[model samples]
Target: MATLNKSVPLSAYTQFSRAEWAKLSQSTTEILSALEREKLGGIDETISADEVNDIYLPLSQLLYMHMTHSVNLHENVSNFLQKKTKKVPFVIGVAGSVSVGKSTTARLIQALASRWPNSPKVDLITTDGFLYPNAVLEERGLMKRKGFPESYDIGRLIRFLYELKSGYAYIEAPMYSHLTYDILEDTVQKIIEPDVVIVEGINVLQVNKKDRRIPQVFVSDFFDYSIYVDAEEEDIRSWYIERFKLLRNTAFQQSESFFHRYRHLSDTQAYDIAKDIWTTINAINLEKNIRPTRHRADLILKKGAGHRVEAVHLKKM
Candidate 1:
């Protein structure tokens, strides 16, 4: 098994030049057009095509090359053992603090990779689906720490990824409801043999298991590649509060939403409430669990105060 070498600092990693990024952007015009269409049709939130082009295009291209290299390596290993092995899926993990735009990164990469000629069968599964049910968390007095590492069913999540990595014919993962904020027990999304699978979450790179200094395997151990979205803690906190206010006015007002009661607060009051939640729950999770794993990411998209990706750090291979 291969291990992630941590001797080099993230700053030591090289980045794509502006001209190269532009070229990658131009190459993915089709993807950008589709993304624009979604935004215009009001099906998606308003994020620019330039954002998708400049970031996700280059991101998917790099992932494609990495997946190709991984396949070659797997084949070489099989040859050494004199056994025929199927082409396993390339797993990519996207990790970050709350409101760091990791979801957008994951969705953009999925769309970009799915359109690639070499790897059309791309799939995405969020670790959110594996989060313990709200009832269970409430029972354990962990409702406030919803995004914490212990809030997830790590064993089941690991088993699901293991089966997928082993090239199972059809792997079915549980579905989650954002409105209810709980796992949908009877619902499953079947992923047929995909060439690439993107897994996105808050603690995807967490390795330490609390009681033990090292876990048997890091959650990121299953990943062929991993990306971390990074920003200043203050910037992320502000963004989290802003998003919470938006949700409180819109999504939270929905009858089925778990946070429906928060919608009753006025905008200013809601902002204050959201900030308190951030300072108490999300910030603690970021400091203790999420941020520590930044060093383990294969790449990091460091963001500025405006929530735009400012620097791309590609790990030395």
Candidate 2:
């Protein structure tokens, strides 16, 4: 674990090094194959079976424990009140800066959690689906700020979460396409009753300032557990550039890809563009919104170079 700075005040978390954290999963069986790990990992992300056994297996076990505890707590409260309560989904929020590999983390957790005894159902959703369409963004002149907090339909997101917590049998979320870089107009992803819902996005931890004028409720309120993937700013910037170069050679080659124009660019040109985007947009957003919420998460996964989780910071009960 990274040593805490004496200058900083005491935190509510107890830190654990990677070796210490890995010991917690000694009894958990490895359920994913090498092929599955390759498919789940994002571009430039170096995830392996060892990482699964050391980092994610323990995490899945901890999450399952938390879910069971929550169920028991609800049952006790309902019994005392002499009332019945429906089962509510346990929502987990995964937040981090762009290119921080949060999507891979969320998917791995979902896969491992589902393999537990009884085969509990799990659903994963990205906030990209809740982003405004390209047409709407152009109309509102927010094209450059597409990933900013203002680009999302906060009301719709809140209502969907509220309904889920209200025990809705099924809910639909809009689908977004990375190739088109837009929300599909009539497409929706239906989520049936799930034991766990993992909401993954860069801004999931953001608390909108505009909410103060109305009833105060942020999206993080719906999360039973939250994770913030952490890394140094310089390391993240390099990873973003590396991922961008790889995408130019792969996904950007597709004619329909939003970034197809970059596919033909020389290596130097592409590198410059990637660096500019990182410094101007992603880095700014990280400093302003995402990093401020790291302390708010129930758990923090601190990654080092090569995108390996070196330590875990778990909030003290």
Candidate 3:
């Protein structure tokens, strides 16, 4: 695992080592059960309780501080205006490259944040749900460019975020299935007014180039706070390969899985295929679309070789 550099001379962000950040958990004692902890991670991730205690608990507490402050600020404005307003969700965006364990980070935040006193509801919806359906991608000849910004229904996504901030009573986000590796038709995740909404995906921090000229609201515009999970490109590639190999014996065996054809591949062949996919598709997407947006985040979680968060970089106001 990488160690934090003590001196970050003349940086725009304040840096914290893992230990330094862990000390920030002065409040919030709510903890997930062992079973709950077991259920908090993504495929091929084993997040130790110590890691949660040393990392996520502080993160959860920090989010609570931000969440309450946002509510207070909203209340103050409403009072000054002498008008009643609907409760708006505090949106948090988690962005990162594929296989960077961002899904786990998002889920951990959602689970821990929801467990705070009085149990505020924290809803999570990934940007994968907004990706153009496989049918649409195929029609547009974007199957090879699936994770790219152009492959998503960016208009619809922007509208959905708009509605959340607009305080819609209930909104339906489209559903996506990893097994089929496509958007599920006629299925949606109905989200009521959640106190916090964590939108996780590689695309969350992106600013579409087309929007620059038109001056349109972006996905991050709706985010009250945003986190970008960072790591070495080669580390993520290795993680991707390991996950791919693991899936060959797991999800790939499912008849309905989009990659079911790869179920019978030998370990060596699986590595080769995974390497090829990562090299040609995922890595390209990360470089061109995802990693470029990391600097835009309010907070960046720098991960080391073992998927450990070695340091934290918080943007200075």
Candidate 4:
């Protein structure tokens, strides 16, 4: 097993210059299979290849290395204790402000990690499935803070992760719909012994201390690694507005979308609406809750105004 000096912090492990960082971030030639590539292509309007290369590829590689070493250590310990070998899944937590590209990061990491020679079966899951339905949020008076910690079914989320890490062969997680903004009743997203699992959400790592009844094993307790995608407040606000405008022009125009009312807006009106949502809702959430988890990440990807990652913060090894 590789030894990470216990006394040394991970941040000091390696310092890459601008060129060096970019070089290290390059993607390998082989990615997903043809069918998977076609499916992922549909999301390209939101996520880009350059972003995947600079952010997700390197992050996934780092996680792979970390997982490999962890497995080796676990095997050594098991042998020392004369215990039987057991399967252990590597869990990665991706957290950030809504519209800060956490979803893109999650998808890219899912694709990249699965391509890793060491970990060939990686699965991606989101905490959206754990969110209360819009009706439930409205009834609970939490409609305004839909992505808040209280808006989640924390018990179910914890149980799912626990089962996955415990080597369950076929674990089921709820399915969530962005168009309906609700959980799909009786539907499940199945997982079958994945080597790596990426769990993405706005508050994946939030620990509630006020509720003494809350168990010590929070949602993030299962993570073997964690990533926080970060950008400046101004940059993120701009990106959010742009994404909202894009959705208004496309997805929001669909009859099935809950926000179809946005389809009637003129370009100028749509821009204003997007700005309003960003400034009033998303911005408030970022400031009040999301950004606070920055220090809790195992790795941090800091993006520039151009939306490309400029620097990386890996917790000292």
Query: How many clashing residue pairs are found in candidate 1?
Result: 0
- Between candidates 2 and 4, the TM-score winner: 2
Model 2 residue runs over 4 Å out of place are 1-10, 211-214
Q: TM-score of predicted model 2?
A: 0.95
Candidate 4 or 1, higher lDDT: 1
Model 2: per-residue Cα lDDT over 164-229, one tens digit each: 888899999989998889998889989998988999998888887754767788899999999999
Candidate 3, residues 189-244, lDDT tens digits: the string is 99997878999999988887764557677899999999999988888999999999
lDDT of 1 by residue, 1-317 (tens): 23323233556477765345556654644466754436432122345666677776788778888887888898999999999989888899999988888887787788778777675688889999889988899999988889888889988899999899888989988889988889998999899988889999997999755667444866788998999988888888888888888888788999999899898898789888988988888888888778878878889888776666777778787
Ranking the candidates on lDDT from highest down gives 2, 3, 1, 4
After superposition, the stretches of candidate 4 with alpha carbons farther than 4 Å from their true spots are 1-18, 25-55, 212-215
Deviation from native of the Cα of residue 41 in model 3, angstroms: 1.2
Report the candidate with higher TM-score, 1 versus 3. Answer: 3
Residue 87 displacement (Å), model 3 = 2.5
Q: Evaluate residue 128 in candidate 1 and report its C-alpha lDDT on the 0 to 100 scale.
A: 91
Instruction: Look at candidate 4 and tell me the lDDT of residue 11.
Output: 52
- The sequence of per-residue lDDT tens digits that candidate 4 reaches over residues 21-101 is 657755656455555545554332234455555555666677778988888998899989999777678899999887777
What C-alpha lDDT values do all the predictions have?
0.80, 0.89, 0.88, 0.77
